[model samples]
Target: MSETSKVVLVTGATGGIGSAVCLRLANSGYSLILAARDISKLQAACAALDRPGLPSHRWISVDMSSDASIASFSHELATDGTVLDGVVLMPPQMRPTGDCQPPADMWRQLFQSNFIGPLELLKSAISTMRPDPSQGRGAKIVIISAITSVQALGNYATSNVLRCAWLAQAKTLAFAMGERGIHVNTLSLGGTLTPDYVASIDLRATKAGVTFSERLAEETLNIPLRKYGRPEEVALAVEVLLSPFSDHMTGVNLLHDGGFTRAY
Candidate 1:
């Protein structure tokens, strides 16, 4: 983190929405610092990002589900010695494991993946960002939550229960850091056209006593927009919130669902 470099650390950079956010942020000229447990995928993403005229960036291997990994990442960030401009946190989802339906252990694992892990990552990263506005480095931390947060859906008890916790933490971080001039927000996304979501739908449907077609039809009927959102569509909101365009906002949970969550 050169003092001159506007650093943006994006965790879970190998995931579907995470990857899209990375691409959009890179295009916006922030020197990217990407992290994921999958070094191979990170390498591929990093290689793809080495544009002819883009800012220099780096990728690292770190496990979001483990405190040691988060601690290591935090130290690594501090060594860079520059206050970050923004952080985009997305965690690898822990799906219902084994024989379809979630076992007790599976439920805990899923919660850890969706809500616990990202909160840990956010707290760790926030500690490294310079907190003084006098230094000209106010930061933003954006958490990628989901449309499921507002509604109870299917057999996704893990994601459903944990999403509440995630939103609570977003609200907490917003208040906690508001005095320091840092902005915190959450982006509740609709179903995006990502391989991971396709995989999640099939897996959850099989586990929830629903046929794939039934599940698919149910989702199609719900979205007022009548279609799944593209990953870029969700990523666009993330890029805007983290950019200077949204400097005045904080603690907002902007919903990007295709009008699917009708709790409005």
Candidate 2:
């Protein structure tokens, strides 16, 4: 199958990393289905990816935290007979501060957004993804997670737990779905200088009585690369995973952490 004929659904499509992935895939000739909670932002994201002569992209409003919303979205995809060639699952990046041990409700919320909802969507998407005999592989599923999954982050206890669960689930699915030709993998990222991360740096700087540049430097001190990742760089990684380059890879958690994770 040609890249132009492939359809990729990117959840959280309007976010920094998500938007970058969408643009990269679009430029590589893949049709995109941009999914997010906000209709206006989804429209804007879709519009931004629109090229003059390329295949037009589509958008859908989906809140990954809501079970009803996920069910509805899944039904819509099935009913519409949407054949997905790839799915990029970018769950909500919720960094809840304050308790090291959060409440049960907090854990539930985190699990739903980070694990349960994405799992359901992947199940639904897998049904729509038929392996192309000509290509000898089925669809690709890329779960976007944080480096905190492998390394703990202060005040992000819930994320620390759930992201690990997400990675385990991806590995399990990769094994379970290998026979079906569906490649399941994950991208665990480090401090990427997205708008969100920049704002976070600004807040940390204020609290620490330092400038943004100083705080940013402190954040990258432990990383061997001594720099945070760029959204465009992440997009390129997503593209490679989705392309034929990853046909032999599965059940792998590829870390884009700039050498932040030292454990073997």
Across 5-42, the per-residue lDDT of candidate 2 in tens digits comes to 78999998899999899999998889989998999999
lDDT of 2 at 20: 90
Provide the RMSD of all predictions against the true structure, rounded to 1 decimal. 3.9, 1.9
Top candidate (lDDT)? 2
Best by TM-score: 2
TM-score of 1: 0.84
Residue 135, candidate 1: alpha-carbon lDDT:
65
lDDT at 170, model 2:
89
Clashing pairs in 2: none
lDDT of 1: 0.77
